[model samples]
Target: MQFCDECGSMMKADGDRMVCTNEACAASSERDSDLEDQFVTTESQSDDDVIESTEDANFEGKPKSTDVVCDECGTQEAWYTLKQTASADEPPTRFFKCTECGHRWREYN
Candidate 1:
């Protein structure tokens, strides 16, 4: 990951140069030829298959299940959790996340 020297914003690859992602920062620098762009990908899984997951730092330790489907991607597996968004007497909201495409949804009991 590269950062802009002028505004300290994150930089993305643009051909052989590292261009700043910040719209306001026009800073750019030459990229190393040896530094190849890395892209991690995963194979799709069936609805009744194993719970798919990633090694992303933020995704670590999150509980997952296959009880829901994503409206955007139609994946049948997802990571799930619950939260109390309403009054104490009310039921907690059940949130769901698509394991395939990272889509989020919620359910009220």
Candidate 2:
């Protein structure tokens, strides 16, 4: 008897394929093809492709998303405060505050 890789349950061979009795286990097997498709990377054929990838990785021409809008004046301006700092045991984090209305919010990684 073959075993189900997902659930470790016994699988019955049916002609050319084996089947899992558990519904969740069966669903997981079906997802492998989808996962494989996502991870398939196409190779770049020219130098222009390398330059474009480098620019993207360096965040060139990218607009900053750190600014918070002022609710009262509809202005695209705000203030920020750092709530956490990097240490031997922890990582750095930041939070923002609206300068006009004192609205506070936390930034996520």
Candidate 3:
């Protein structure tokens, strides 16, 4: 018997596997299937992916865009976040809302 690391629930060892009694434990086989991106390192991934990851740290509290001229109302700037997709085939997008007019736009990465 073993205890679950996440919920501290009891688990029973069956053959080669240990299952928690909580019945909510995630199977290890499904963990990798939920990966948003397969690339692990910038040196080995595509240029776009590398650039996206580099910008992630700056997304925390950074302005939407540098010298970004709002096409709708000529606003000065806005705030944004680093939005990532499940894969490279997925769209690269970011939210940009006008601080003055509240007009939002999705800037694709």
Predicted model with the maximum lDDT: 1
Q: Rank by lDDT, descending?
A: 1, 3, 2
Candidate 1 structure quality by residue, lDDT tens digits, 20-46: 989988888887766654521122324
The window of 10 residues in a row where model 2 has the poorest summed lDDT is: 50-59
Model 2 scores a TM of: 0.27
- Residue 4, candidate 2: Cα error in Å is 58
Highest TM-score: give the candidate number.
1
- Candidate 1: regions farther than 4 A off: 1-60
Which of candidates 1 and 2 is the stronger one according to TM-score?
1
Each model's lDDT comes to: 0.69, 0.46, 0.54
User: Could you tell me the lDDT of residue 68 within candidate 1?
Assistant: 74
Against the true structure, candidate 3 reaches a TM-score of 0.36
TM-score of each: 0.43, 0.27, 0.36
Tell me each candidate's RMSD, in Å, in order.
11.9, 15.4, 11.8
